[model samples]
Structure formats: C-alpha cells, structure tokens
Target: MWTYQHSDFLVHQIPALENNYIYVVADKHSDNVLVIDPALAELVRDACKQLNITPSHILNTHHHWDHTDGNAQLVAWYGCEVVGNAADTKRIPHISKTIHAGESFDIGSLHIQSLDATGHTIGHIVYVIDDALFCGDTLFGAGCGRLFEGSFAQMWTTLQSLAALDEQTKIYCAHEYTLANLSFANSVDGNNPELQARIIKDTQTRNMKLPTIPSSIGLEKHTNPMLRALDDDFCSAYNPGKTPLEVFTDIRSKRNVW
Candidate 1:
C-alpha cells in the first residue's frame, strides 16, 4: 500500500488483482473515508484497520467487476452509502446514490465533484476531491482505458475534459499500468523529451518496486501520448489530415494490439 496526503484528505493506494489499484480516501478532520473501486474487501478492511478509520461511503467510477467486486461486502460491513454513476445503477452493485456529471457533494468538509468519464464504460465517472482526481480505468498514468462500451469520440472527449483540469491536479487513476503505458507512449511519441525522461524515471521506479501512480495532469499533458492526440506532431504522424477523433481512433486501435 502507498499513501498520499492532500490538505484535507488522505489517499491510500492499495495494490490488488494483478495491476489494479483500490483507493481509500479519508477526511482528515472527520475521519470519514470513501473507498474507491474496492476490488478486494480484505485489503480495504486491513488498510482501514491500519489507518484507524472506517469507511463511510463507497465510490465506484464504473460498473466493471474489478472496480465493484467488493462493493456489496464493504457496504454490508460498514453500512456505507454506495455512490456511482446514475446511468450505471443497473450494473453497479448495492449503489445507494447515483450521481451525474457536474454534480457536487460533501463528505465531511471535503468537496467532491463527479465528471462523466464514459469512454472506458458507458457510464464511467471520475471524482474530483480537492486536488486529487479519482479516475478509475478511464485514464491511466501514460495512457487511457480501452473503449469497451463507448466510442473513440467519447473517449477522446472524456480525456480532453480531464486534460483541461488544473495542471497540478493529481490523477489517481485506478491501475498500475505506468510502465507498460509509457513503453507504448515511447513508441508513439518517441521524440518527446519529457516522455523519454519519464520512461527512464518510471523504469527505475518500477525496478525499485515503487508505485508510479498519482501522476499529475501537467505531466500527462507533457508526456502522455493519449492526451497528445491533438498535437501537430502526433496528428502529422498518425492523423495526417484527419480530425482529433480520427487520430485518437488510430492511436487507440494501435494500443489495443500493443
């Protein structure tokens, strides 16, 4: 488990199920914590115990099994409110509250805003709490999620929305795919100095068995190939005279096989 602290929230990054990440965000003042994408109940339970905090809510970014597998168990154990995208009520288990894009809520003193991130899944949503973005599989460190139930245009639009956020916002995407994603990013934008530096830095971090997550929007904008689909260089190479959506489609298709 890796821990990161914001001004009023504490985030725990729990590694689970191969490369998946389950985040536990707690309010510093109230100790009210919300579990994000709890794939493994035991890991979440153990982390809560160690942190001396109990979960008060569960936030699901999507309906994927890996993201919501422990939702029922956690809710049963904590009697917590489960929040998920309103459009995915049928899919997310034990969801108590359905939220939509631009909706804001309060957990203790922490303010959270939900953004529709529907490319990874049709009803995918990301949570923005303070400076942290609890983006599930919709976005990754150096890449974005596969278009499982949405279109390339949807994914591209979703990513563009995230890219427009505060550059310093820490992206808490729910996966440990930095190394692999950066490798593919290197292939796509090989000439980017920032990307090259990130490849070396992330390689060392992975070699040392450390987590390379919580990447900033600024860093992603500078190095992430998926976010750079609109760049002139990227468009020249992969899109030619095509639109950003067309370039994004080609990049995503290539990543599917990569």
Candidate 2:
C-alpha cells in the first residue's frame, strides 16, 4: 500500500513560470504518487525520488503550458494515466481519461472528486482530495484566474461551488499571485480590516521566502475582496454606488492591470 489507512497525504509545491505553483500528491506508506500540473517534470520526478515516492498517475487541471508542460515527459517516465477535462483532449495531448465534473477516483486511500471550473479558461478544473483542493487557475487565495476562456458569470458560479465545500478545505491554487492580488485588494478595499490583515500576512510570507499558498477557503471568504462580491463593504469601497456585478467587474479590471 502506498498509504496506510490513516496516513495523511503529502503535497509538494513546485514553482514555475514567474509564479505558477505545481503540486504533487503522494501516499506515504508505499512508493505510489500522483502529480498535479507537472510544470517541471524532472523537478517533480526528483522530488518524488527524494521523498521515496513513485509517480504513477497525473492530473492536469487545464491545458495551459504551465500546467501541462511536463505531461508528455512525465507520462513517458511513469506510464501514468493523464487525466483532464473531456472537452480538452485535443489541446491537452496526453489525456487518457477525459473526466467530467463530479467524477470520482482513487489515489491510494484518498477518494478524489473532480469539479469543473470554467472561468479562467473554458476547460479549467479543480480536483478535491480529502480537504485539499487543487484549483489549477480558477480560484486563488485572494484572486482568480484571468477571464481567458469564460465569462465573469461562469467564474462567479464556479467560485460559489468551491466556497460551498467544507470551510477548512486547503485551497492549492496554481500560482503565487498572492502578493500582487493582495496589493490590488488593498488598493480597492483598504478599509477592510480583514483584507488589510491578510495583506500583512501575505507580505510576511513573501518576506520569509515562503509561498502564501494552501490558503484556507474560510480565510479566503473573509479577506479576499474578489471573493466578497456580495459584501456591501467590499462593493462600496470599489465602486461606491455600483451594482454588485459592477463592483466585481471593476475589481477584476484593477486586478488585471495589477
């Protein structure tokens, strides 16, 4: 067995593409492991070796280069099944299982759930395991992926689904945009004490050369101005008299340029 019945899963954060964070999940009892968004295959492979884990499966959240750049290499190395959104096999190149939203699978003792999130990109997806969510480029700690393939409405709905998860879920988003996103949050909602406090914490993380990731979903709900669309305080600070969606639009725009 790669993992004992009660062993907690392990995750490794691999930095890439200016700020992208790739993840690898593994079972501790045995050598089996699964790679998520293998942006750097060799690094992922080496990391697995150092941890005494062997990659036998891969989950790609999207077809973006930063997410799937190492797919071919990793697949060749592990003979792993490459999983992704069914609608994106043509673009993804190595998708062995074209998974749908809500599909379930097993990785060691963990039962995984796939959530389709089409906002940053049309085929963007987030994978959930236990209390950890591998949200490729959809929901971030304090921001969201750019509207590269879907509408704000789509992203909005997707975020709501993620928020509906258990409050303690550790969100492993795909990038290290916390500092930049927090900067934009402060620019728009400086009066929000929670948001302000989060910015301080994010700064401290960066100052310590630590990744401000694996952020809890509950904290994101309270401090992420982008995620607080319905909050009157957040909306009022950004647009003064704008509708909720308008406020959301403006906040997104500033984030775009941030």
Candidate 3:
C-alpha cells in the first residue's frame, strides 16, 4: 500500500488482482471516507481498519468485474452507498446512487465532479476532486485503456477533455502500468527527451518498490503517446493529412499488437 495526502483528502493506493489499484480517499478533517473501485473486499476492509476510517461511500468508474467485484461484500459489511454511472446501474452490484456526467457530489468539504469517459466502457467516468483526478481505466500513466465499448473518436474526445484540466492536476489512474507503457512510448517517441527521462526515473522508482502512480497531467502531455497522437513526430509513421482521430486509431491498433 502507498499513501498520498492532499489538502482536503488522504489517498491510499492498495494494489490488488495483479496490476489493478483500489483507492481509498478519506476526508482530512473527519472520518468520512470514500473508497474508489474496491476490487478486493478484504484488502480494502483491512486498510480501513488500519487507517481508522470507515468508508461511507464507494465510487465506481465502470462495470468491469475487477472494478466492482467487492461492491456487494463491502456494502453488506459497511452499508456504504455505492455510486456509479446511471447507464451502468444494472451492472454495478448493490448500486445505491446513479450519477451522470457533470454532476457533483461531496465527501465532507471536498467536492467531486464526474466526467464522461466512455471509451473503455459505455459508462466509464472519471472523478475530479480538488487537484486530484481519480480516473479509472480511461487514462493511464503513459497509455490509455483499450477501446472495449466506445469508438476511437469517443476515446479521443474523452482524452481531450481530461487533457484540458489544469496542468498540475494529479492523475490517479487505476493501474501500475507506467513502466510498460513508457517502454511502448519510447518505441514510438524515441526522440523525446522528457519521455526518456521519465523512463529512467520510473525504472528507478519501480526498482525501489515504490508506486509510480499519481502522474501529473503536465508530465503525461510531454510523454504519453496516446495524448500525443496528433504530434507531427508521433504521426510520422502513418499517412500524411490524417486527422487526430485517425492518427489515434492507428496508434491504438499498433499498441494492440505491440
């Protein structure tokens, strides 16, 4: 487990089921806590016990089993309200509150706003609270999720929306894929100094057994290949005059086989 403290919230990153991350966000001033994508009930429950903060809510980004497998158990144990996209209400177990894009919710004094990120899944959404973005599979450190439900254009639009946030915003994506993603990024953008530096830095961090998460939006803009799909150098491998969405689709196809 790794922990990060922000101005109004404390975030705990609990690794579960291979590379997946289950986040526990707690109010800094009170016992109010919100668990994000509790994939493993035991790990989340034990972490809550150690932190001395009981979860009052569970926020889901999508309907994937790995993201919602613990919902029923956690709701049964803690009676926490399960909040997810209304479009995925039937898929999210024990759902108590169905939210839509642009809606805002609260945990203590922290205000959380939801963004429609429906490329990885039809109901996939990312939550923004203060300076932190709790993005599920929509965005990764240097990669994006596979287009399992939405179109390439939809995913590109979603990425554009997230990229428009403050450059300093911390992205809390749901996987430990920085190293692998950066390797692929290096293969595509080998001439980028920032991407090379990030690869070295992330290698050291992983070697030290540290979490390489909570990457900043500024850093991703400089290194993430998916976000750089429209860059001239990045699109050089494809045909000229390709639209951003077309370039993005080509890059995604290459990554699928990479």
Models 1 onward score TM values of: 0.97, 0.91, 0.96
Can you write out model 1's per-residue Cα lDDT over 1-258, one digit (the tens) per residue? 899989998899999999999999989899689999999888999999998899999999999999999998898899989998889989999999988877999989989999988888899999999899999998899999998899998999999999999999999988899999998988888988999999999999999999899899999988888888757777877657888788878888999999
The candidates, ranked best first by lDDT, are 1, 3, 2
> With candidate 3 superimposed using the best TM-score fit, by how many Å does residue 184's alpha carbon deviate from the native?
1.1
Over the full model, what C-alpha lDDT does candidate 2 score relative to the true structure?
0.81
lDDT of candidate 2 over 24-114, digit per residue (tens): 7876655567788888888888777776777888899888888888888888888988988887888886899888877888766777899
- Report every candidate's CA lDDT: 0.91, 0.81, 0.90
Comparison by lDDT, 2 against 3, better one: 3
Model 3 lDDT per residue over 69-187, tens place: 99989999999999999999899999999999878987678799999998998889999999999999999999999999899899999998999999999999989999989888887
Poorly placed runs, candidate 1 (over 4 Å): none
Top TM-score model: 1
Q: Best candidate per lDDT, number?
A: 1
When 1 and 3 are scored with TM-score, the better candidate is: 1
